[model samples]
Target: MRQNTTPRGLVQAALAMTLVGTLTAVSAAIARYPVYGGQAVRYAVAAVILLAVARFGDRSRASRPRPRLTVREWSLVAALAATGLAGFNVCVVEGTRYTTPAMIGTVVGAVPVLLAVVAPLMERRRPAPRLVVAAMIVTLGATAANGLGGGSLQGLLLALGALAGEMAFSLLAVPLLPKLGPMRVSAYSAAAATPMLLVVGLLVDGTAVVRIPTAGEAAGFAYLVIVVTVGAFLLWYDALGRIGADRAGLFAGLIPVSAVATTMVLGLGRPSAAELVGALLVGCGVAAGLGRRVRRPAPVIAVTPGRESVRVAEASRP
Candidate 1:
């Protein structure tokens, strides 16, 4: 109502998760592709697209000077690329060998709680109790949505690594976002991640790395490059800067819900009652975490001619 960016931030966060969640299924299209090699391509393509859009397409942004990165900031971007981008894509793909996707998703679902706890601590403040509790609720909702599927010990570890990457994706960017902004951060991180992923692809696939993709794999990579990499990164990082990591983190719960919804849309399966309840809980948790408040008019005091105060029935809204 007052030019508040929080609502916009919330919407962006939701949209980002939607892209990520819906694309979760689409990723299987490229399952046969070399994992590291495919991701390297995706990141490289996305970085170019982002850089072009950020630098050339936005004329309004031309006047604003871009910030140069300090050494520490460069280090952070490197770590973010390595762990959050390269490591996450590799482990998440590899993890499926040891367990069900639901189990891995269930473990990775803890990102909300992780961000809610760690983000505030990074700022030298105690975590907000309400936000923390809401994060827990969202985590529970995600777990329910994922059906609490079972996994092997190694799968559990891999899922934990994915969780760390997801957490780092936001927390590390918290420092960089204010300086570089979302577009630059997205652009730079994607560029940085390409080399790392390509190296891994080379090591893993040897001379066979970076083969020509099939039609379906090409389509899948296009979707990832345009939506999940370019669009989701900008949306999430911008939201994180606006509403902060704690609040934005709650939207991570939507990943599983959106995945379920996508399955339904694709006629793959119907959602169970637990998933319905989980979606409801996710909505409730996000609403509560955002501090949705209602206001009422307070009783007012009136001054009579004698300057004495008299009780009045109503007052304007505060």
Candidate 2:
């Protein structure tokens, strides 16, 4: 049986991509701050906010006691914190220092491709042929849109690190989402990462953490904390729950497309011909990857006592 895609899942995926893509510009704006310091501050704030919401804000869920994480579950949360939140942010921030935003965007766009490959291994089954083809197309489009230029060797390596971290983040959280739900998973992951980020920031950057951010940096930081870290993580994980990781992962292709559009909106850069073509390809790939095959109802055969079987066709349900 084919899996069905829902509008809610699609909207969640789009919102996730938009929120994450906006981070490209946010990162650029705040690049001057020490890498660990900026990320630590951003995530620390996000963690606090998410924890508050998880604890006090959901009146509808207030009756239910919060679920406590078992040792095994805590271990998974710790892993997610390390790979997805803290490690991913660190790599991305450090990578931006050495590389252009476009380069980083291009590399990050490969996430879906990595997920497509890894999902099967984790699930112990082969991916569908269409998924593989769609992943390849998305990769090609992302590369074309974000041209491979203006980045150092160190930057490229760091970007690869970021890619690995992100892939781990997405794949690792899938199993946990069903048990904990998206909000709890996100809150715990952020909470776990926050202290680690703070410690790293203090150890690496020292007094920089105390220094006040400039107006633009402050704005960017707010966006990252509120939108990218909290909002995006919740939406993405929720979409993963609704659609499953294999389908949800395909939305990663939209990140670069959204990033380029964001850049243009910010008057930072214009899309080139290659980027335009690449955007089209990404749209096509996502549509194909998420498209569901409609199954026709099987013909009902009535067995008769006398002789022949009568075939009856049932009308398709809406």
Candidate 3:
């Protein structure tokens, strides 16, 4: 079943990160809106769009019986909505109040290393040393790109929470991706997150929880719905399914890198020499980690009655 799909997966991962990076600028328009309410609207619209596309885009595929989600899958879907979607957004918004956005972003940059170690554990495999080293290099690159920024202890703690949420975003989705596929997983998670955010909006903001957005806010929501939520979520989950999470996590460094590039392009700020160095390191790390991986042959076991079993590695494929 496996083929030369890594290159395509890499491209998808990179594109997804780049799109997400642009949100640093795009989200500005919605800053004045109610946080939970705005998020609710974004997910609601995104879920609708994804459902339509996934349901109708291909006639043959659409005609096939829709796969039923198991109880475990439903639980995973709920957890994803809670931690990755709602919880992550809450941490970020609250984190920025206590810490500089740079600090929060830099903290989240550590996700590469976190995923390198944790993802393999989730898969019940030993984490590869090469991948771990590469993850460290990527984290370093992320730090250089974002630069060290000051924040309170509480801010630091909140940033750490954001990091955990970001990691959960990938780790939680790994199991579901293979079965539900990217489209359903993304659509389902977005749909699940919608009500949670809406209820939070209601409790927190009262009757004014949702207001008619201004033109700028509307435009921002449009980008978020179509590009950030729909496009990025689909591409990210698709890449995760294709390439596996540890390798895919490395591309997350591109998020801050891409954000910095966007700033430079818009004349918001010129990147420093350190930022340039950071970008280079990210490229190098990704290259090293992705070096042609050979799937190890499975082990064979022999059992005879009244004798100790024998286990040995199978011969490698030519």
Q: List the residue pairs that clash in candidate 2.
A: none
| Cα lDDT, all candidates | 0.87, 0.81, 0.88
Q: For model 1, what is the error of residue 139's alpha carbon versus the real structure, in angstroms, after optimal superposition?
A: 0.6
User: Which of candidates 2 and 3 is the stronger one according to TM-score?
Assistant: 3
lDDT of 1 at 167: 86
lDDT by residue for model 2 over 1-318, one digit each (tens)?
Answer: 122478898789878977887777668888788777777777778878887887775666777776777888889999999988888878877888899867876788787777777787787988777777887788778888888767799999988888888887888888788678888888888878878887888877786764689998899899998889889999998888777677777888777788889999999999899989888988888888877867677666566788786767675546
How do all the candidates rank in terms of lDDT, highest first? 3, 1, 2
Between which residue pairs do clashes occur in model 3?
Answer: none
lDDT of 1 by residue, 1-318 (tens): 111335788899999998899886797789899888888899999999988887774576777776788999999999999888988877887788898888988889899888888898998989988889999999999989988777799988888888888888888888888788899899999999999988988888987778899999999899999999999999999898888888889999999999999889988889999999999988888888888645668887776887666758787675
Runs off by more than 4 Å, candidate 2: 1-4, 57-59, 96-103, 150-156, 294-318
Residue 217 error for model 2, in Å? 2.4
Error of 3 at 287 (Å): 1.4
lDDT of 3 by residue, 111-148 (tens): 98889889989879999888899989999998999888
- TM-scores of the candidates are 0.87, 0.85, 0.90
Q: How do the candidates rank by TM-score, highest first?
A: 3, 1, 2
Q: Which candidate ranks first by TM-score, i.e. highest?
A: 3
